[model samples]
Target: MLYEKLLAPLLFRLDAETAHNGALGLLRRANSRPWLQALLAGRDRAPEPRLEQTLCGMRFRNPIGLAAGFDKNGIAAPALAALGFGFITVGSVTPRDGQPGNPRPRLFRDVPNRALWNRLGFNNRGADTLAGVLERQPGLPVPLGISLGKALQTPIDDAFGDYAYSLEKLHPYADFFEICISSPNTLNLRELQEGSRLDNLLTGLVKKADDLARSAGMARRKPLWPKFAPDMPPILRDIALTKCRELLDPAIDAVVMGNTTIDPAFNPDPAKGGYSGPPLFPKARDQVRGAAARLEGRLPLVGNGGIFDGGDAYTMMKESGCPLVQLHSALPYRGPMIARRMVEELLQAMDRNGVRHVSEITISQPSRSSK
Candidate 1:
């Protein structure tokens, strides 16, 4: 209440990217204070009866997570985990060690619609630096998912190698891995989501993950999920699912039901970058449900995009058959308190639905038959 009513308004006055950096910087510094960490820890609500979930062979203290792009470089994983997210996903980290990304003014806020648009272009300190940060930070209270992307100038043919390089360096630190092939800012990146290209990419990635697991003497391979675009048509969706099934080994754990949307209907402002928030709700849900139906419950789905509150999150779970969901834009609109509120609301929904455990509700619906 205080942050939205007072602090956010002040922050809103500055450019969106500047405000983002400033806020992260503050959190990073404050996180150094034991008293601040204690305060944040106390603010976290006690776990609800059925909200604990174990997915991809790992346990999540709760279902709510901070999505990728929030911590583009893994700088604040410890702070975010302390604030009570079931998981903190860092990066969309690229393989290259060069340029940080587009100049300022790359991120914008469409305040009236509670949406955000960005062409930040996978800005990060590169994979090696991110690996070092992960090693230095205290281990998270919950799981950590790392999102990987191809380098800015890497050609499509060589993207697989770039992604594999990042995976090799960061795998030891991540609980799960997310392949980001859907961000619209990158040139021809969407092609990677197509059948043929995706097959090659996953083939290489799965092999690499397997080798890493064996060498580390781990019993199970890490979960590797592909982040998808919300705008894919049914035919394209089928191609995506088929490709994933054929190419992505069962060792590949889950699919996050989207990155963001490039659809103009969702973004009325004619913004250049992908748009995320409430407007993306319906499409994101449909895509998740569609993918679940086609995959026939074989894949674990992490639904994201347009989750503003618990009702919205519940809708995504029920309608899309997603077992887990993540939030990004909502934090800025509702503040960090949003996580606590969402946990409360999710517990209420589970109670009303008579679901004993959250994972039991995941992918409960079978795909609808085509007419």
Candidate 2:
């Protein structure tokens, strides 16, 4: 209530990117003080044990996670985790150093829709700088995920090298890695999602991660997940699923559904930046349902896009069969407490539905002919 009634109005008045950076800066500073961290942590109680989940061999306190793009440079990760996300995804970091992103005015807000349109182009200080920061930061409250992406200057054919370099550099710090092949803002980046290209990329990166794990004396390869685009055609989504099921066991660990969309209908701009917010729920939900039905629980699905409240998260779990859900745009509009509120709502919905465990939530698959 405080955020929506007071903080949001004040924050919204600033230019979009400026507001975003300002909030992150405050958070980063706050996290440096013990009392501030304790105060923030005290606001939300722990989730009930029934919400506990183990996926890709890691135990998550709950299924709610902050999606990848929110903390793209690894700044303020522990502070973000203190907000109560079960896991925090930091970085869509590239191998190159200091990549300047798209021009200013790249971020626009659709106030009534509670949506964000952006073409920031994966701007970050690069993998080496992020690795240095991670080495010095305090232990996180939850699992930490690193999202690896191809460098903007890299050729389409040489994209794998960029991903491999970022992975190797950040491997020691990350609990898991999300191979980001789906962001719409990067040029020809989505082409990496093509069948053979995706396969080869995942296959090679998995090999690199395993080799690193062995040299570091770990038990198994670190978890590798792929983020997909919400705007994919049904056929492409199907192909992506088939490839994921065939690949998850050996080359991948889980799948995050999906990145922001490029649907032109959202605005009048010819640029059609990646769209994320309330309007994306329907499309994201359908993709989750379809992907879940296709995978048939073979690999876990982490649903992203358009989740503003606990009810939205519950629907994603029950109707779309996502075991875990992630939030991005909602954090800005609804505030940091969104994750705790979501878990609380999820538990209430579970009681109403007479379901006891997270695994018990599943929706019937629509007939194959519907595809």
Question: What TM-score does each of the candidates earn?
Answer: 0.94, 0.94
Whole-model lDDT, candidate 2? 0.82
lDDT of 1 by residue, 38-127 (tens): 553446556665777666777888878899999888887777777778888988998746247777678999898889988888888999
- Summarize candidate 2's per-residue lDDT along 328-347 as a digit string, tens digits: 99888987667777788888
TM-score, model 2 to reference: 0.94
lDDT, residue 201, model 1 = 90
lDDT of model 1 at residue 334?
82
Q: In model 1, where do residues sit more than 4 Å from their true spots? A: 32-34, 38-42, 96-98, 249-252, 364-371
- Clashing pairs for predicted structure model 1, backbone only: none
Give me candidate 1's TM-score against the actual structure. Answer: 0.94
